[model samples]
Target: MPIVQCVPNFSEGRDLEKIEKIVQPLRCKEGVKLLNYEGDKNYNRLVVTVIGEPKKVKDAVLESIGVAAELIDMNNHKGQHPRFGATDVCPFIPIKDMTMDDAINLARELGKEVSERYGIPVFLYENAATKPERENLATVRKGEYEGLDEKFSDSNWAPDFGEAKKHSTAGAIAIGARRPLIAYNINLDTKNIEIASKIAKTIRHSSGGYRFIKAGAVEVSERNMTQVTMNLTDYTKTSMYRAFEAVKMEARRYGVNVMGSEIVGICPMEALIDVSAYYLGLENFDLSNVLETNLME
Candidate 1:
């Protein structure tokens, strides 16, 4: 069991005691398996999921990003998802026989040990991109954290480690190594929200649409509704029943419909066995010939 799955995206989901003091260092880490959580107080963010081993899940996500860089300030952050840090966007996913160059060398050894142990400024996207325009984690979180102090005090976005700018309270972190991404969401019976923000710009992928999806559309205010959220990344190149039927066919052009769909954390088992083999034409299905998953080993 090589499994190294992490999915941390935290920007303090509406402060439940500051998200339990930023997940109390992964609840005092052991073999790290706190798998599943999804706050979303209107995208005040918190996506947490975990797994183990690759050095005990990278020492419990670098000690929960040093306790979310000592209780997450991100200069009085607000959120609608797009965040630069307060431990935002860590990735690392390799499941079993681990490789993606062993999660890109454990994401550059957890982004250079979270930029030399908490000075905070990491940014190493997609297969731990050292460059190539940072293999896009929203173009390395464009203009976020109030445009990140003139974008990392200019070394062409300086961070591959702590501070060429912003971390006065955990503001810049985005480590990587990829694959295994799911975080879905749907919700839409309509309260408009600009028809869920134009069906998240017609099914996200840098606004041209669907290429392993990556949407937006939000508004939940205690469920008044209007979402579309996504990440999907590869799900074997866009599956999850083709991203919930492509946002239920873009929420039926304004007459909206889909009111249930979510899965923010812990998603593996071939993403619910590839949506029950694309809605049940199960044919040659074989998950070790499933009999309660090989009857407890």
Candidate 2:
């Protein structure tokens, strides 16, 4: 299958009706399967993941972006995570036979078209970064929504597409192409958000922590726990064992224990296989024997 994956972040997570209103279009979109939709209350973010034929995926995204512009306005948005738009960032990733260059081209095409149609400024990031500085997502999201006005004023931060000015309703978006990533988090057993925050600072990339780790801690209301959520950018480069162990080690110092961990959306089977091998002392174990390999199409 010439499959490409797109994960688009939209600003409205507070209202289920509103989310359903926007996602209704995806059900009718040809060649796209909504792998998952995970909404984070603290971050006020809804991440919609889908995989499909190139054109079908693009059409679905275009529709989603249009609905988001009409329904969401970034100026009034507030969340724990950094963002700059209603439909903040959209990324396309290669799966199986698809190549990174193919994903990059798809991202470029989407960025250009969305910019032209919606007037939403676009920044090409990660593997799709026009320059090395933009390769790191943390660098691009530094200012967040509050800093967009100033960021646009600087010549150095010129958008890859669209006008330097921000869109009245949608704000700006960072569209990119990247490797398969895992949205993994380890929630520490503590109500004290401070400890979780401190541990988060010590583990994320921006604070001189793990290089492939982009992370932060947020409150999970129902659980009443502060979670250290992360995007393991290159899980192949940095294993989940290392991530879990690192957090386990850091949380121990703060007098906290690992409550539990979660894989927010669909993660590649190799991640679990890698964790099993590391934890079970099966250094040479091949994952072909695992049933998950056959289960995930």
Candidate 3:
């Protein structure tokens, strides 16, 4: 069976009951395996990682989206993460015996189905984007939920699937195919969001920072700390250690200490290995050195 990984980010992270309800469909699905899931109260977002046959994975994702739409109301939703829908962004990643094209096709199929069935506008992003501009998710979600209404008025901003108008409570969804990405966040000790924002701007791609990094500053109100949340688009180009160091180096200038770091959902083991090798100063350390790597073989 051809395997594909789907990470669907839903907008209700604070409510455990609703989050469980949203992910209930993925639990007993025959062909799908729920690898992991995490809810961040700070961002008010839920990140779920699952892998299975392409069609089965798509089916599971669609079911979860429906549940998310029914449970989460974006109209009253508030969080540190930028989102425009109940099921904010869903990305499909090809894993075993699958190609990028196969993932793209699955994304399109899921997008069409979700749009037709739920009446929510769907935008194809990343590799599945229809236009060059839409290729970047940040660009596709430029206006966020608040500006979604006016965004639909522009011809250039019309959705790739379903009506251009936004869903009353569920809002809109972005579905696409892309390579594996790491959702890493670095927390700072000080409660000043400005320091976090500055560090984010210095390390993110849009601000002429790293090549494959998209970053933003978020306030974790409950903890009274700030975070530099990031999406490492291609870890091969810009490793996790480099991003972490960049924030650490920048934080020093603001006299802020590094609180800790977090990985939102499942990440490739190689990414962690690379970080370990760098921090440990181990020469030529690779997956071959990992005991689990040999066991898998």
Candidate 4:
């Protein structure tokens, strides 16, 4: 059995009714397990994690994407996170008995079908990108939804799937195949968004930070604080502890203290173990030393 993990992010997060409706398709589906789903009202985004046989997982994701398109109108959506579609980005990761090429093919198939079914222009990103420039998701989403009209008009910006035009309501989406990523956020005590943005620019890969980090800043109005949100693209290379420590170091420079930190969805157990080793000053500690890890096997 070829197992794959699919993480799909949608643009609506505040409405419980809509969120449940969108998630209903993946529930109790044979050969697919919905691992977790998280909604951040501040970001107005929903992140769902599911793992299963590749084909079954793809079908479940496709069904949920349809629900999102029917219910969410990108024109009326507002949030701190950058987005360009009702179903923003769907990524497939090969988990077991599979290869990168298999995931890439799954991404392409889903992207094509999504375009055909919903009339949403799709961009293939990460390992599934057809062009080098489209490989980085941030580069592809630079203009966002508001700038999609201008972006679509540009010859070089033609989508890999669908017509060279934006969806009337849902906007566009990016689908791809990639390694596991950790959606991590570090909050600062200060409400100053400029400080957070500066820290984000300093730490993200494109801005000369960690090679596997993709980061940005967002203000959590409800919490009266700002956050340095990140996607730790490759946790083995750039551990959560490293990113958290970097943020703490940067915050100190501005006389801003670290408020707290959070992981949006499920993260690898090894990522947390790395953090434990650093904070506890444990020498030569690893997952092998954890009791639960041994029991789970």
Number of the predicted model whose TM-score against the real structure is largest: 3
lDDT tens digits, residues 178-268, model 2?
Answer: 9989999998889888888888889888898888888888888778788988999888888888889999999998789997899987898
Once fitted onto the true fold, the runs of candidate 4 whose alpha carbons sit more than 4 angstroms away are: 288-297
TM-score of each: 0.34, 0.94, 0.96, 0.95
- What is candidate 4's lDDT per residue for 174-252, written digit by digit as tens? 9999998999999999899999999998889988999999999998999899999999999999999899889999888
lDDT tens digits by residue: candidate 3, 69-96 = 9998898998878899999999999988
Could you tell me the lDDT of residue 72 within candidate 1? 78
**Candidate 2 residue runs with Cα over 4 Å from true position:** 291-297
Regions of model 1 farther than 4 Å from truth: 6-53, 56-81, 91-112, 115-118, 121-144, 147-170, 174-193, 198-215, 218-228, 231-239, 253-269, 276-280, 283-286, 290-297
Please give the CA lDDT of all the candidate structures.
0.81, 0.87, 0.93, 0.93
Across 126-205, the per-residue lDDT of candidate 1 in tens digits comes to 88898989988888898888888888777888888766878777778888888887788888887678888788778777
Ranking by lDDT: 4, 3, 2, 1
Question: How many residue pairs in model 1 have overlapping backbones?
Answer: 0
- Which model is ahead, 1 or 4, in terms of TM-score? 4
lDDT of 2: 0.87
TM-score of 4: 0.95
Better model by TM-score: candidate 1 vs candidate 3: 3
